[model samples]
Target: MAGDGTIEKVSIIISKGSLEGVYPGLIMANGARAEGIEANLFFTFFGLDAIHERRWERVRLATVGNPGLHLPTWVGALPGVSALMTRYMARRMDRLDIPPVPEFVEMIADTGAGLYACQASVDLFGYRREDFIGQVKDIITVGEFYDLAAGGQIIFT
Candidate 1:
């Protein structure tokens, strides 16, 4: 609380790698920063792909098993559905003037927000420090994330 029950900071934990999963956290963190709140993004588990050097741009919208698609699971599971949805969403975002993932990450970093990769996940995924994009501040443990998140709200996306 920032002296009147308003949030002053936020720690966003991203655990999903799908395009839909990663963007919410990014948008939230960016919104937090826009509101003058301190924001930190902690990428772990599959979320690691969002910050990965080789995987970020390739992340696809998860149509399969996603009820939000409002389609039968089998339909979503069909070949080319995910890619089509991903392209549609990407075009929509571009129309809305939203930057692509890499540029968005850089934009957020330029605003002084902290971006971190989970150390455990990095090791489990066999990723070196250099495997992340330049915007990632560091690979940190959960405890370290907690430390950075002190006196803030924690949002798991």
Candidate 2:
């Protein structure tokens, strides 16, 4: 906490691949930066897709097993449900002037927030450093993430 009882820094861990999963952390980090708070985003597990060179543009909203959609599991399990929902959400976001995932990532990076990929996840996914977008500061281990996130609030999204 800062002298005014506000957080001085924030470290967000993103572990899911869906649009909903990835965007919250992005928005949080962006908001934190806009508020003059130091922010760092740690990408791990499926969340790596958001920073992946090829997958970022294809990251979709997960409709299946997502109770927030207020739809039955069977309905969400339909072949085209996820795609349809993703398209709908994308249009909604666009109408709100929110950029796409890649552009949003770039925007956040431009704010000087540290963007990192988890080493364990990268190795498990057999992803090379070249596989990540240029905005990634580095692929670091959990220990390194903790070190970098020191004196900051840690949030898992």
Candidate 3:
């Protein structure tokens, strides 16, 4: 390891459908790229929402059970709370100039990062290959994912 202990690459699996879930993975991948490290993202299950052509722009936190919110899940589930929170978060992110999921995905793609979708998720959701963003390189099995991720730190988001 170097003095700062930087890894050469990172493989991230995004498995949540919520905005909160996808943001961390994107942020980490972007950070890794900025540091000149190889970064790859494999979107699976609900995480597929982050790469979904029709839904990526609309993903919001399913605050119903987000323990990090410090409020009763029921309170978050109440009518209108989710929308309000989503709007608030969007404005905050706007202030920071952080692009939305769609644009962020594009930005990462332009940076030479690889984006992948899970084949099992596509089968389970009844989605076709064309349903995801054009940047998706492939819909792969977990074993293939692991093979490509070998020797890299696998971070699950």
Candidate 4:
């Protein structure tokens, strides 16, 4: 439980390896921080792409195998399709007044939220420390992350 103070601790577990999943975790963590909550995000599996320097710029929208995806799987699999779709979606989201992922990430980092990439996932996926973005706090073990989550409201996004 959080202390009886002004700040509230919120732990968020990001497990999905998709562009859609990554943004929500970041947005929520940042939003919580904006409200003076102590936000912490644990990135696991494909979600690590959001933190990886090499992969962050190349993060693609999941058009295939995503039940909520409006585009067909074949279209998503087509070369340049995902990129085009991502751009289109970004434009559409902009029209709807939604901020881009990079901006959201900057906002989250600016709010001083703790951002951790899963060490086990990094090793399993062959990612190095140099591969991650500069804002990442550390590559933490699952046990360590859970230790932080204990007694806090944990949400999987």
Instruction: Score each candidate by Cα lDDT.
Output: 0.93, 0.96, 0.91, 0.80
- lDDT tens digits, residues 66-143, model 4? 667766678778888778878877889899777676666667887898889999999999888888888889899999
Model 3 CA lDDT for position 44? 94
User: 104, model 4: CA deviation in Å?
Assistant: 1.8
Error of 3 at 3 (Å): 10
lDDT by residue for model 2 over 1-157, one digit each (tens)? 8778899999999999999999999999999999999999999999999999999999998988898999998999899999999999999999999999999999999999999999999999999999999999999999999998898899999
Which regions of candidate 3 deviate over 4 angstroms?
1-5
Candidate 3: tens digits of C-alpha lDDT, residues 53-144: 89998999777888887779899999988888888889999999999889998999889889999999999999999999999999999999
lDDT of 1: 0.93
Model 3 scores a TM of 0.94
Candidate 1, residues 46-71, lDDT tens digits: the string is 99998999998888999988988898
Best by lDDT: 2
List runs of model 1 lying over 4 Å from the truth: none
Model 1 residue 92 CA deviation (Å) reads: 1.1
Write down the lDDT that model 4 would get: 0.80
Please give the ranking of all candidate structures by TM-score, highest first, separated by commas. Answer: 2, 1, 3, 4
